[model samples]
Target: MTEHPDHGFLTEPEVTPEVRASYDSDVADHGYVMNLSRVWAHSPAAHDRLFELLADLARLGGLTFRQRGILVSAMASTAGDSYCALAWGGRLATEAGDAVAGSVLHHDDAGLEPADAALAAWARAVTRDANATTAEDLEPLRAAGFDDRQIFAITAFVALRRAFSLVNDALGVRPDRQLRDDASPTVREAVSFGRAPADRPS
Candidate 1:
């Protein structure tokens, strides 16, 4: 783990001219630039190049933005990565109009249609143990209507995000202050909204 730098752009980042234009649009759309954006930009050229690659890959995944975000969140939480879980998870919850369970913790097939459940379960299984994933796993997702290409793309995204989580944790990077702060008022109220059901039907 590299030592955390004292510079804001090093420990964090502010907008760079080349990246700012794109970041501005994203912030406008989402109401805030994600903290990852800031952190990545600390190495402007490298980060921008990598982000461009990631953007291309994420687009190839063919899931809706919400779907992609949810898969990432589930994997992060399952892997015990709180920073990734809270960061993207909170954004997902806000986007879903229900910050209560952010995509990280919410997993009920009842809420998803058959196809979505299959996709989500595939994500869970991969996160739990990639070596354990088999053709049988893809079978359910394929039967539920996901194409092979989409499944492969999802697999890629999961792998990429997991790599990202490893970096943040090894660096001992604290959760972004913005996320910690934005996690207030309405966001907090919604995050703590619901309680889990106590009984599990056997």
Candidate 2:
């Protein structure tokens, strides 16, 4: 077992087969078990299922990697979730560039194309208050060429991402050190809210 400290407010959990699988997946992708993985390992099955649903939504929405990054960064930043903001902001930087990613995190869509800008705005609206959104709020997405199905998918995607962020934030899960360290300086600077990153794993 990796000798890391407890992930969040909860104590470290025993490494059951499911938990080990979750840890292994994290290690395979990131070269270390992420702090969030440790926290989610308490319910590895639920964690896996949540990601599977996210994947399904992404696929159904026909979302490109860059689009996913834009949606996540915009939504996370709007919701004050530093963990997802840093993680997806770093990815958006890779896909779109640091300036664009930083702009999205800062809630400025000036750097994005028309469609992406609309997407980012929609994400923020959803995060800020879903009920506050009206048909008028979705007009830009329609004008930007997103069909009703795609718009529905985008809305669901933001909602699901919000749910994930809620769990991590409410449970006191700090952003992983690796996530913070790996983020571009622009992303790190933009992610000024939410729980601070965990200390480096010993």
Candidate 3:
């Protein structure tokens, strides 16, 4: 087993009183705190910057949270980071009351559509081998109804997710309890997809 490196409680930097107070309130609203949130609180500036970018993505990205979460999960898989896929993807799925297994393994649930699946496939490709992705791969997404804005959001979401995955992996940050406890066995199995390669012979 690949053990995650632990940086203790909140791992990015020092948390300020103001940010800490706000963070408590924010996480309380959801009833759980994500490690990513702690990492951002590692530094006040880091927290501010990350929150700003995330807020902008939520407001102007044109993609729904679930769709963006799928892209994040796929990108994490392509990057060979089980921790990331299960951590974020698991929480995202839990919130929707959807099967985390389907999300982590790249399967479409009633929550996701064909177009969303195509975007996920595209995200995996771009995350793994950006240069290798041809225009043909994008045709399905375009034909399925994703406009320029959604496409842009998908691309951006994948890129940022790759960054997020690596940071969490390197720090050995622990995913929240819901990811470990609330996740179904099937979902835990799906995390292996992150360590598996598509090119491997079946």
State which candidate has the highest lDDT: 2
Per-residue lDDT over 106-165 for candidate 2, one digit per residue giving the tens place of the 0 to 100 score? 988886798889989999999998889989998999998888988888889889999999
lDDT of 3 by residue, 1-202 (tens): 6533233234354557866775786568656555556655656565567656755665565667676667777777667776667665675666554464366455443455676667678888888888998888888789878776767766776777677677766655555545555556656666664332112111
Candidate 1 residue runs with Cα over 4 Å from true position: 1-42, 99-106, 184-202
Give the C-alpha miss distance for residue 187 in model 2, angstroms: 0.6
Higher-TM-score candidate of 2 and 3: 2
**Cα lDDT for residue 108, model 2?**
86
**Shift of residue 159 alpha carbon in model 1, Å:** 0.6
Off by over 4 Å in 3: 1-5, 8-15, 29-33, 95-112, 193-202
Model 2 lDDT vs. the true structure? 0.88
- Ranked by TM-score, top first: 2, 3, 1
TM-score for every candidate vs. truth?
0.68, 0.95, 0.73
- List candidate 2 segments past 4 Å from native: 1-6
Q: How far is candidate 3 from the true structure (C-alpha RMSD, Å)?
A: 6.8
- Cα-based RMSD of the predictions, in order? 8.3, 3.1, 6.8
Q: Model-by-model lDDT, in order?
A: 0.60, 0.88, 0.63
